[model samples]
Target: MPSSLARCVLSCALSAAALAIPVMSAQSAAAEVVPMPPHEKTFASPDGPTFVVGSEGESINKVPPLNASGTVREVFISGSSYTRSDAPSGGTLAVGYHVGCAVELQGGNVGVGPNAYLNPGLLDQEDIGPVVSINVGPGSVSDVPLLTKEVVSGVPARIMMRDIHLVVNGCIGPAVVRQYTLMQLHTDSLDDIGVVYGDPLWI
Candidate 1:
């Protein structure tokens, strides 16, 4: 009888261990971190300077906020942008991200509410600074600037950003985010604007 009872206990323990395996695997999959592929683009104006921009980053989907229905994501994007002009003068370059949810942002339909106010002072800043967080609802979009600075001709400006903790409240479903680089070249004859866009990532 003693040997029989020991065998029974051993069988129950193995059964419990087997049941726990799937749960553990599910939890591990939920916390997985993924590295996004690097993206780059180049834009040139007619008889003007050429602008090149690139971004490399990674992202992780974290647990949602307490008592909230949305998800929280940790994202990091590093961008390098430069301008080349032979007209003796360079231009200003601005780098930022276009974050959206459930909307086709690539179709050029970014809906900003009437009450939304974008800080004008961001344009005047010469350093990479954090922009104010915007609450994006379903089917909405927001622009988050990571950095902006002046770029000299034939010189490159590198902006490194990491550990960006974004709490997307009230946002349901998957979210999409992409980086944009805009440069304004001031030449002797024409002041032209060039833009480069990074590949979109679904987070």
Candidate 2:
């Protein structure tokens, strides 16, 4: 049998070891539960525009909005106007016209044209696309290549139409167009919209 002094030391040592067991187990469990960060990449369009897409962040499935300012390089009618008569008696006629324009940034990059479509029903939907706010200036339609003072001042403009599709004519082949919107409000910057996790732990 051990002496009382030795027995007391042994008992204390065992108690300390027992206390340490729970702490070590807790740390191990925490390590196992924590998830790893996601991968990311930056994508650019042929017209010298760029955006980020990745497994993380608010714009995971959708393209974020872009802010660009530059001089107008070219403006032309990319599509023909559609005309429809109200009745056989040659009543009022409705016309739908399409236009195309490009802007040359002060830094020499080009903003091809602004085009976009809106789906009001998709407001609460998920995994569809990003929502963006667009702003244009007065006389924007007529003031191509020559930006008005309002536009230069960055005044939020309005969108006259939605679900717009403009067909470009006389290109090497069917060209890819980047769509954007024009409105009065601005969207939050990319940095302000932080990363978002969307996958299972095992993934």
Candidate 3:
């Protein structure tokens, strides 16, 4: 990625975080830190299976909030992200509008809400996709079931799916998703948000 575009992605990420920060307050804080579970990482993508993990101090969130009805653990490794563009200047302009959608979970029982106000901002470009992937490892996919999801075909967000609820099976608990909405705030036909599992043990 070009330096300028990279900067824009970073900026958008910040904006999303800023917008989502308020939702943190909605999360109920709890005492006691849950011990991080011992985990192993492996991949099943056609690229080939690889593994990585070391016993350390990665504290396990006894509880966690849901992102758009999905598991927050999706970022147990790669962290979070926001909108980005292919053009250098376009990235900047697009990112400016994506403020405050960052992945922020306060402990294990908190999270950001969908349609959660985005600090109110504007930009020149409304086209850009949020970067998504597990560039790193040692995290587990949330057991939260995918209730309903559909992709926007022929569009950059085609990679970014939306409106996946976790309770259609009525098996989901608040521990998974209390209330959430997954909407495409912005996109650029790249870096679509996709889902994957890490290990069977985690399943």
Query: Which structure among the candidates has the greatest TM-score?
Result: 1
State the weakest 10-residue window (summed lDDT) of model 3: 92-101
Off by over 4 Å in 1: 1-29, 57-87, 103-132
lDDT of 2 by residue, 25-139 (tens): 7644432222224444343333332333233111111111122122111111111111111111111111122122231111111122344444322222122222222222222
Per-residue alpha-carbon lDDT of model 1 for 1-203, expressed as tens digits? 56988999999999999999997777556554456566566666677556666555534344334343444443434335444444456777776777787643322211123333345324433333332334544356777664567777666665555443444444457777776767777778878776667767766
Off by over 4 Å in 3: 1-30, 44-57, 60-203
TM-score quality measure for candidate 3? 0.19
Candidate 1's TM-score: 0.60
Q: Give the Cα error of residue 173 in candidate 1, in Å.
A: 1.5
The sequence of per-residue lDDT tens digits that candidate 3 reaches over residues 1-203 is 56998999999999999977766744434212333333332222232222221122222223233434433332222111122222211111111010011222211211124332122122111223222211112232232211122223222211122211111111122222211112222234432222222221120
Please, what is the TM-score per model?
0.60, 0.22, 0.19
Error of 2 at 159 (Å): 38
Relative to the true structure, candidate 2 reaches a TM of 0.22
Better of 2 and 3 by TM-score: 2
Model 2 residue pairs with clashes: 57-196, 115-180, 134-182, 134-183, 135-183, 136-157
